[model samples]
Target: MTDTTRPQDPDSRCGFVAIVGRPNVGKSTLMNHILGQKLSITSRKPQTTRHQVLGIKTIGPVQAVYVDTPGMHEEEPRAINRYMNKAATSALKGVDVVVFVLDQLAWTTADELVLEKLSSLKCPVILAINKVDKIEKRETLLPHLDMLSRKRDFAEMIPVSALRQTNLLPLEECVGRFLPQSVHFYPDDQITDRSERFMASEMVREKITRQLGAELPYSVAVEIEEFKHDGKTLHVSAVILVEREGQKKIIIGDKGDRLRSIGQDARIDMERMFDNKVMLRLWVKVKRGWADSERALKSLGMNDF
Candidate 1:
């Protein structure tokens, strides 16, 4: 279904676009790059994104609502993975365009699996060959694109460097053509479809993933208990829930050093994001087996799982 909320003036157009692919193809990075802001978190690790994040980008006559979805991969075959995959699949429904982002370094069976799904999509599909900066020669990139182009029918194929902000405007222009004329879906100044609390939790999670690394990143959740603004400063308090006492100890660190570092990093980013000083207090709590517990997962916004 086309989004008819945008103004119908000759110069007005708005629509939704879904960026889908296997994990770590720079979907979140592309969203942030297009919006010219950090609307979503980025991590080198796979499956860093767990939700369908909306990033708004307005250029001339078009406002593109870009949905950054979780990476699709085969896992334990449980409810969580099912939900995550469903979130990505749901994004394909009723959209103006679909950008199938791909990593240039390597193509795997899993990549084919994602493309196979895209081949069945009804909307126009654009193959965005991300990480073009990693490719040394332009000629070398053609073969990779050709291989995938032959596998499915893509509306348009374009190479882009989402991290380096290269060759993106053309892709944006290409996407804008698919948007229907309508009223603006959001204010021109709006940038994302996430709440401050949600963004704050995501920032904390990004820091945790960066410092603590993989094994512990997936086992943690951040809950914002207090967020208050007093004109002078933004005071925030959050709980980092872990699945075990050992995980809690690891997060808290020796004499709370680790937790302190994480808090400091998150606070700095939060301050920069909000354009004000932030007082952040972090505490670690244990909710053993929360990831596996359906009730607990639902409370943590993992209900899709």
Candidate 2:
């Protein structure tokens, strides 16, 4: 006899929720916090996310598949930037709910771009004012909240701090209410749709971005050349692609100290995520004009959207 019990509750709720915003608005952080794990790469740098990362959360009868998309920026100086914008815009389509994340009391042309995109969305749009923890005056928020309501007829407006884990329960509840009635799309144990190899590359890229900060622009990308397992350890070899020899030198640092530091940080993260010891190898190579070339971008998995 085959014992396959029910996959989910008969009356469970499940749907896709796209999290959209401008660059550096904490969209990835919010999705990571909501899932209680880091499914998307995040850094202080703008445009840190260049693809649509799916983070799935299942609790009881509710499952929310959150799409953490690239930040929408108006400037498409290169083919990669245009690809990022396209990925973010595509996340809005066929979604059951949309969470428009915004920085606390700060609005820019980029935010306006996101707002303009949301103007025609059919799903429920929830305005989540993030970074409220940074706000000193609580009373000032009321006026800002009042002003935000005029922007659109948002389904719900919640003040939250994705970094501090504040008011997230309310936000989850609000999101849950909008999910349609359906069986879960993914297994409850599954946290993300991406493979371990993809996550390894993202970890390496994140470490580079965090370590170098503004020193390295969007000219860097990571590709996993090898992923294998032996005994109890997982071995990963990645190549860091840069646009110029000078950029390669910057990543390698003096006497390769910077590269070693980046490797260590990334290995630690991989260990935690994989729950196994990691043997990570990194190499920096100059891949000139890869970002500006659409074919190169597609080869690097940046055009999957």
Candidate 3:
């Protein structure tokens, strides 16, 4: 009989790393770039992410399980907003390292709120100065970097452009140093903890968010009515929930053109993600005050975090 024993590497490292910051600060973009895939949904709108997304990257013997959290905001006027805040802060617990993302040289009251949470964490925190490509003068960043250093004793600070994929290797190296040595927690080939169904809903929601822009508020939510695979084609039916009839009409657009465009764009992404032909159907429904009701949020699966 042949022996089938697998030996563990002594140098292998694995741990959770939380990516956190104020809304629209490129936290999702940073993790997507680092993992070399789009595991988290992103938009220009603040608080685009409402749950905790895990993007796992395994390189050689080192595995970094990144928790891509919803951006922390100062306001929690609605139940959904409070849920997002809970999701973001929960990612910090038991994390081996924390990557605090900041936009360029700007700091606001929202960033101050995130800083207050970091003050109590015992783990290492690394400051990632994102959108550095927007800075016209390189010399101007030194003074800003010095000012940031005074705010907290970060484990490491590196300037990076998440969109341009610049200087990210150094950032990854810095995060890897703080991870503890242990056996790999997940398979190397697996990229995310989210299921295909969850990703499908996110793809649909991303299209809606991008299409509506400022015309629509955060009251929009997507629920997958049907997800079935037949032959070589994947069929998906998603219902878009809104707080008011006017919001539904806006999403439907004149002659349903906007809804068609959103569905077409979302199908393209679903095809690429699943590597199969996708047939998508969308419907708009009015669900008033869903954002403010905790019961409604739980029914929509928004309270899972």
The model with the greatest lDDT is: 2
**lDDT score for residue 104 of model 2:** 95
Q: Could you give the C-alpha RMSD of every candidate to the true structure, in order shown?
A: 2.9, 1.9, 2.5
Q: Tell me how far the alpha carbon of residue 252 in candidate 2 is from the true structure, in angstroms, after superposition.
A: 0.7
Which digits, one per residue and each the tens of the lDDT, describe model 1 over residues 181-215? 77778777677868898899999998998888855
Per-candidate TM-scores read 0.93, 0.97, 0.97
* After superposition, candidate 2 runs with Cα above 4 Å error: 1-10
Screening candidate 1 with a backbone cut-off below 3 angstroms (N, C-alpha, C), the clashing residue pairs are 5-183, 6-182, 6-183, 6-184, 7-182, 7-183, 7-184
Worst 10 residues of 3 by lDDT: 1-10
Q: Could you tell me how far off, in angstroms, the CA of residue 186 lies in candidate 1 after the best superposition?
A: 1.4
Error of 3 at 219 (Å): 0.3
User: What local lDDT score does residue 100 receive in model 1, on the 0 to 100 scale?
Assistant: 87
User: Total backbone clashes of model 2?
Assistant: 0
